[model samples]
Target: MQLPLFPLNLYLLPGGISKLRIFEPRYVRLVKLAMASDDGFGLCMEVNDNICHFGTRVIITDFDQMPDGFLGITIRAMDKFVINHQWQEEDGLRFAQTSVLPNWTPTEIKYIDRDLSQGLQMLFDEYPEHAAYYPQPDFEDMAWVCQRWLEILPLGTEQKQWFMSRNDHRAALSFLHSIIDEELKDK
Candidate 1:
């Protein structure tokens, strides 16, 4: 299926939220059409001035007119997808045919981990508005916890694509452990 693309240099995982402010006529039209349909638009990252190979399917959860008069919308990423074919539309919105990427299975958080849970809380504490965008954090699911962390980190699209291609998030968890260890040493 051909879907409109919203390109940004950002990593968004399943269960992640993207708050967008749309003022462009094409985007405003895309938002309106997506809101009226069940299947939403394609959200692809712009890598080196081109659309990244990977993307996510987004479902509009909330919408409003911003104080600056722009159309504001919050969308939740549902699944990972890779672009198959793409082209520009007459309206200037790019459209792409994508195939869904394999998803990670949720793993139970076997033990309490402050780095995973408390770190997220600290983030929310510093940026209170973000707490409102997501439903309560999933402290019980290791995959959920790890994916959220990955989304927050500043990594290149290539690095992110590598991580996503892995069989599971055990590698991600190991890397995260090293970061948390260093953080503890600093404290």
Candidate 2:
């Protein structure tokens, strides 16, 4: 499938939610086009002035004109895709030919360590604005919890990309365990 691409510094995985402030004309057009069609656009990372190989296809869940006069839109990521080819339109908006990446099978809550979920919940407690994006957050599903951490953590773009490229959540769960365990030990 060909998807409109929005190359930013953000890493969004499936089931992740993020809010974007749209001001650039190209992205604003992308948003309008996305909202008009069920075929959502691709959210990708721009590395060295180029779009990364992997991205998430996201749908606009809500939108409004903010008080600051910019368009505010909340988006939910649906699936991950790998860019096969890309091109730009006259408006400078970019589009890519992509194929869906396989999703990680859902991991049960019992398999995920309790601290990981608690650490994620703590983040939600501290960042209500980010938390507000998800009215009903899933703390039980291991994949959901791990993806949330991957999105918020200050890990390098390449590192996050490597994690996303994996076929399952085992590596991510282990990584989160080490990080969260170290954080807990520091306290």
Per-residue lDDT value at 66 in model 1: 91
Best by lDDT: 2
Could you tell me every candidate's TM-score relative to the true structure? 0.90, 0.94
Work out how many backbone clashes candidate 1 has. Answer: 0
Model 1 TM-score, all chains together: 0.90
Worst 10 residues of 2 by lDDT: 106-115
Q: Write the per-residue lDDT of candidate 2 for residues 74-168, one digit (tens) a residue.
A: 89999898899999999999999999988888887774498788878998999999999889998888988999989988988889788878878
Which regions of candidate 1 fall more than 4 Å away from where they truly are? 112-114
Clashing residue pairs in candidate 1 (N, C-alpha, C atoms within 3 angstroms): none
RMSD of 2: 1.5
lDDT of 1 by residue, 134-176 (tens): 6687877888888888998887788887776665778888888
